[model samples]
Target: MMHPRLLATSIAVVIWGCGSAEAQTLVLGGRAGLTSATQWLNQPYFGYQRVHGTTAGVAATLELGPYFAVQAEGLYVEKGARYYTSYQMRMSYLEGPLLARLSWPIASSRYRLFALGGMAPSVELRCAGYQTVNNPVVNFFDAPPGTSPLDCDSQRQRHTDRSQVMGGGLAFDRGPSQVTLEFRRTRGSDIAGYDC
Candidate 1:
């Protein structure tokens, strides 16, 4: 697999090239967002838990034309499973998306739309994947009489694979500023993690 720093660099360079000529025309901004996933993705978990959580991050977008742009974001998420012995995991990631956007004004009502697909390489910093075991580093939500602790070995590793990113949103523009509501999903591996 590629190094995390290298992956991020490649994304930046490629995006820069895609809109280099119109770099000045790009709209520079930041994003505040969150993420959630199903429990199936958290297999081999320490225990039976909800496995749903929120991830927050920021992104910057580069627009080459009215219909073409590139965006990059970095995020951190905390998640856990609620079983006999609950376990928690923390993930950090950086993502890049090649976006196709459209914008036009209808009288005084302005609108903007964009769709994106890209790669996201992530790093697993802290994870308590073995809470079911007798000696767990983290606490639990609910456990059976003797579950011998949940399988938490997977949480003690790091993966940086190219993850999949896809999503879009609508925005209202007024002059140089706009307000947008967007949603996206970063599909990671079921066992390989969000990166690998």
Candidate 2:
């Protein structure tokens, strides 16, 4: 029931001069960023609001040539939605993303610009802000007063997600190491048997 929107900034190190005379072919890095999340619900009375979260991860890249490369990352992210001003639906996941990149050097400068697109598959690690109520016969537009708000995890059997990633970045080349700043957007696809 949650579709996430994410913006990330990261820095990576280009590993070079490892007893090779060729250009750098491998990079390793770590990143941490903030996330804003929201969800869509079937109930018309409930209006979802954005909740804040965090993302952290490690990444690796393999250069295929001067202008093309492949990258992979392992990330842990927090996502959810806020409703009713006090109720929050929170979830955490471990994600793996594979991306294809295209890069080119800026004219007469030590900077490179790159664009990337990929897919990330995630497994839910934790979920909260939901409870079962057997009393009063809960239904749409009806709920027991003072009950915990409903979350996607309580309404669905699927605890996994596949998200799409797209972004661009600028890198500063400094000898054997490079520093990169990137902005990315991720959108989650609907999971089977999941509803809110």
Q: Which candidate leads in TM-score? A: 2
Whole-model Cα lDDT of every candidate shown, in order: 0.53, 0.74
RMSD of 1: 7.2
- Error of model 2, residue 169, in angstroms: 1.7
Model 1: per-residue Cα lDDT over 1-196, one tens digit each: 6799978975665564454473435445556655554334333543234456566666566566454556666666554444434344434444444444444334455676655566666655554443335553433444444333444454423344345777777766657766677887666654434322
Lowest lDDT block of 10, candidate 1: 38-47
TM-score for all predictions?
0.59, 0.72
TM-score of 1: 0.59
- For model 2, how does the per-residue alpha-carbon lDDT over 63-161 read when each residue is reduced to its tens digit? 755666779999999987666544666889999988877788899798989999889999999876644444535445434354555766554567898
**Candidate that would win on lDDT:** 2
Per-residue lDDT, model 1, residue 80, is 44
